[model samples]
Target: MEKYLEIIKNSYSSYWNYLKNSVFMELNWENYFYGLIIISLIVWGLEAIFPWRKNQSLFRKDFWLDTFYMFFNFFLLNLIVLIALSNSASELFNDVLGIVGLSIKNFQLLEINKLPFFTRIFIFFIVVDFVQWWTHRLLHRVEFLWNFHKVHHSVKQMGFAAHLRYHWMEPVVYNSLKYIPLAIIGGFSAKDIAFVHFFNITIGHLNHANINWDYGGLKYIFNNPKMHIWHHSRELPKERKYGVNFGITLSIWDYIFKTNYIPHSGRDIELGFEGDENFPKGFIQQEMYPLGRKD
Candidate 1:
């Protein structure tokens, strides 16, 4: 237990410095602090200029709430998770491997570092996106996971910020499940391609934005608003009660797996699940929502 406590302590200290840098002196080109704001503004601008739903309000319902969610999910909640959870998880997992005289580094089936820099990032993007695709399916098919995901589906009005208006637990599940698959390919640190993170953020915003572009030919390669709104439809397709369009950053998985569906333009389709009107609107209440406590 002392060792675990020590690990948490170190995690806190390390995260503190990183957070301080991100908050203060880390305004460099790669800084997500500024990137988040910039990317959000760009998408919001596009939506305002050419909104698919011309009748919808610019200040849509829960717009500020979803904005808070974007920052919270990206920064505030991340701090707590890194300090108190992920560090211990990494250490414990390594210890378990130690039992068998192995380490995470031992599972490098592809030796990814030897590959070209762009090649590594490209592979990481595809593999990680695929893992997230499967994890998304789990969120819908598994009742327990769906409860957490409901926070996201609670968005009645889709906007750029709606991309991140998910229960914090979603990231925990996404990251945890992606760990092993990434490790198999030498676990290339995501930092190797800072642009990959930015790219996903851009796509995520666009996917949930109030836009109608399906990227024409590239629609299958990348997720877009037209292809993704069907994902948030309140009613499920007759043949797909488990949900559909489980893509995160790319739509290829959905097309390949036969999970893609768009019967029409869906320019003004209803969003949210049944009973989402009862979903908590306050951030605190929503965070506690998956715990089965309405109050």
Candidate 2:
């Protein structure tokens, strides 16, 4: 029995090393796609089974739109990564703002073997959430930024795809803007970077979920579905609650900013903008609206 256990451990160790070396090659498009599909399926399955709102339609008109934007969003992100790889404007931007003086790519060691899986994930979440919370709040206070970000707020309700509704430029600029500081701080590796994206995409869905779920006392610490619901409130009184619950992982920033609001009720809250009555519903319209309007 002891011999069998030793053999199992040796085999597992060898297999783990092989997996790390294989992934160290150029981006495995197959595995990349696999990771994306896995994330989407898990999120979609959760929505179907433990839906925030029981009667919510999983396939609504906005649902399709959200899905479309998800693909588009990813396309744009990959394009940026590509450009950053090449010596283009995107790379230039990354250079000027990157952690090091002019290095665009910060391929830190993908430390898959050094730690337990959960420990690595926990560290990544903490680092990524801190950066995201501040950047999200900055978008609210800065009027120019609010324009790009408003596309996200323009949504009337949260759907599975609702996480995709954002002005393309908003994320591009925001990503570059935040990553610069993160790179400088310089603790995150490639795996940590992947975890950042995984958490963002996953939590963004929860933020827009129709379910009236909350993390109970946990909302005071973490940004749950309900706290995010208020952030999208259409009522002026509620919209003012923006910037609280800034940390995607933890609501610590919101508590610090006094932006955290624990509601008395549940999913009955109205969503969307309070003043932007003429805001269009379509993606093209939302993109072009700010151009013609004074608001």
Candidate 3:
């Protein structure tokens, strides 16, 4: 027990040190570019060999637009939004907690860092996933939120790049909400957050890819392309709940909440918002879309 505690303490110290250095250092664009290229190549290769919809071309309609969305959201817009919001949101949350006399600093006394590494990772993953799942549902059910989210569902064809095709404001909402829970828990290190982020990004791309694999029985557990494809479907049976299946990394939340919807097959289903045939086609127009009508 003493040895395990020591190991955990050392690991925690090392992670914080690394995080501090990373914050002070220049952003590593080389690594970011390399990772993007590698993941794109792997997904593109798999889609080429075993595509779900053989009729769908690699350069389908709005493909370049989706590519631009990917880079813009991942590289430029998300960074600016996250940096602008994180500190202000954190301070605001802490102040609210102070008013209630329930401080996050006190919660940090619980020493969640002493827990096993994998255990911390597991808890972080589940918490973040559940938070995102709720956020996704809100983006669908709330008309205002849905306006920004419509940029994503407007995709008539699915591809790996489509994973990053989201409105800039969408992340501001989700990321802000996600931080509240983490702050309350008070023990998640930067590394824990990074782990969950990596998992979300990897699975998100896979879920949006054109690949055909469904993982058979695991479809009920993890989000897969087949299941997510239906989430983007333009039509659904009258008896089924509209806007169902909003899970981001795990399908279990949808199953528990009774929003899970999976058709026998999604190959023939037409994807996109039903009445949004004229949704803006360019990145700038789409960015301006959620801000309401312009004369």
Top TM-score: which candidate number? Answer: 1
Question: For model 1, which pairs clash?
Answer: none
Candidate 2 clashes between residue pairs 3 or more apart in a chain or in different chains: 52-211, 53-211
Clashes of 1: 0
**lDDT, each prediction:** 0.87, 0.64, 0.79
- TM-score of each model, paired residue for residue: 0.94, 0.72, 0.84
lDDT of 3 by residue, 137-215 (tens): 9998788888889999998899988988999989888888888677666687766765666677778888998989888
Model 3 misplacement above 4 A: 1-33, 96-102, 107-110, 239-241, 293-295
Cα lDDT over the full model 2:
0.64
Model 2 residue 156 lDDT?
68
Supply the TM-score for candidate 3. 0.84
For model 2 the TM-score comes to 0.72
